[model samples]
Target: MKESSLFRYAVVGLLFTMLAFSCDSEGVINPTPTPTPTPANERFLVVGDSGTILVSDDSGATFQAVTSGTTATLRGAAADADGHCVAVGAGGTVLYSADSGDTWHAGSCATTNTIDRVICYGSGKFVAVGEATGPDPYGIFRSTDGGQNWDRYAVTVTLRGIGARSDSQFVAVGNVSSLNDSALYLTYTTGASWTLYSAPSANFPAGAGWLYDAVGTSGGYFVAVGSDGSLYSADGGTWSAGGAVIGKLTAASWCASSSRLVAVGYGSGGGVSKGRIYYASSLGTTWTEVNPGTIKFLFDVADDGNGGLVAVGAAGEVLYSPPPADVHDAGSLWYDGVSGVANELYGVCHVP
Candidate 1:
């Protein structure tokens, strides 16, 4: 080959060699660290008569469309340890999510019954309770496999809520069709057998007319909530009136770890024209009011323990209450000294 051509070839070869060595030595320039995806944060969901759902990530600070699934009014939802969740509502509807809540496995209630609320009993079991007019006395259903299938456990009266201290022990709240009396209901055998309570009194305004949700405390102390400001006890079977929960008191949820308690519904009765909820860190003192909207009627509330809370309501409003700047819910250690404003968040639960 010519001298100049040969020189050019040598230069090209040298350049190629230099390039190869450079790539390996200094760690391949800006090689991305396999971008560790920002794990999905806990989310809050809202469901109401609109048959649509709203979701938030920043402790109800803001939200966007988490789902447009199911055109039925979603009334209730329950979350499991495996991040699986289910929501039910009008026209006999149910929607399940295995990925925190990004997507869903929608299903028909099969009874056209309105599932008012649902709860997870650990493991893969779930219980949903509500009222129906069709065949038999419709009340509650047991889904052992995270709502894949449902078996009617107890059907009578209007069972609004179901909670379990354990898989075998639980309480379902609602009133029976007898006289002019309303009561709180309990079941020790996972809804197989049930007993009723007086709920402190039978008078309206102060008495629990129709119970909604039940929450179990650390020391066996349980609180059940209902419309028209209702809070009752399930000591053994008979519900005793705990007291008139502040606000409308539509739903009651407890965070045992932080000792946080939340109840949402509406503003004061009588003179109260709209709906609001009462929140407390101790549940033993004064309850604070959260401003969601002018006609905000909170239907449910839940804690995700990610220093946050989610509440849902009648209006299309959803709010979040982060772990108080003090992480205080209802205790001293947890007392972060910050007041958790009960914004109208729909539902909130821990992801991990």
Candidate 2:
């Protein structure tokens, strides 16, 4: 071979040898790291009319339907930190999942009354509340064994929503026989006993409307929202009035990361019902509305476990807001999410 060609071949051979040594056994050089799979506990669970249950594992970007094992209208659901999820609905139906909502099984609530809301607290303790139904209906039910069994609690007033600040502290809000008057109940012994509190007439001077939902904050505060956009707050003792929104709020949730309370419901706009979202930063003392860009009636709202909020409502409407560093920002806007089913969605929860 010519001298020039001989030198070229030698250099090429040297380069190939160096490349071989640089690669691992898989023939990959400095391979990119594989992304960690999303944990099951980070999923969002949505329940609606006709036993509709939708789960989103991708931070509300997409969702898939899951069998709820019942055709009763599911009004509310909650998931514990341990991945246990329980859903409550019409006809006193209760469904549970031990796998973070991947699969569900029916559980006995011992009543046929419609369960409007469900909440899970420390150590698998679950509490549910709804309207009084049937001849022997109890408005509240407690389950300490991950919902395998339940104990009923009798209250004179119908309870619509329940919230817990700790395993021992809880508050339930609803109305008496008439929607014109509201009722508040408190339990400090893990629901062993409950006491009714006098209504704060100053907050609802005309008449206490139906209080639909209540949420407890990490800061030891409980806020409840209800008819005519009314809001009330309690500091573990005294109940006081908070600011009102423009429409009735069916559901409310506290976002610890942002220190904001978000509520969702429906309001009349241009003679048509439209979904409404409101946020309060001053511990529910005042609220400002944020446009969710939808006309469907929103029934429930919850943290998306990704520092954002997910709301579900009429006509299977699912709305999602991006994680706003400041949720109280007036410019914040919500976008639409696909829920697949057209059933009226009533409740949503995120298991972080």
Candidate 1 lDDT by residue in tens digits, 1-352: 9999999999999986766443212122212122222323565665555555555565455556665466676777777778777777766677777765667777545567778777887755677887745574566777766676677644557666766666777777766546333454567766556665543443222445666677775566566666544443436454444544445466766766567667777655445456555555433234554444346565777777544566665445554555544555421111011112233334434433
**What residue pairs are clashing in model 2?**
none
Q: Write the per-residue lDDT of candidate 2 for residues 223-289, one digit (tens) a residue.
A: 8788856545555445566776666888888877667788888876545567878778636778777
Estimated TM-score per prediction? 0.72, 0.83
Those runs of model 2 whose alpha carbons end farther than 4 Å from true positions after fitting are: 1-41, 198-206, 235-237, 269-272, 325-331
Which parts of model 1 are misplaced by more than 4 Å?
1-40, 177-180, 191-206, 234-236, 245-247, 268-272, 280-295, 329-352
Candidate no. 1 TM-score: 0.72
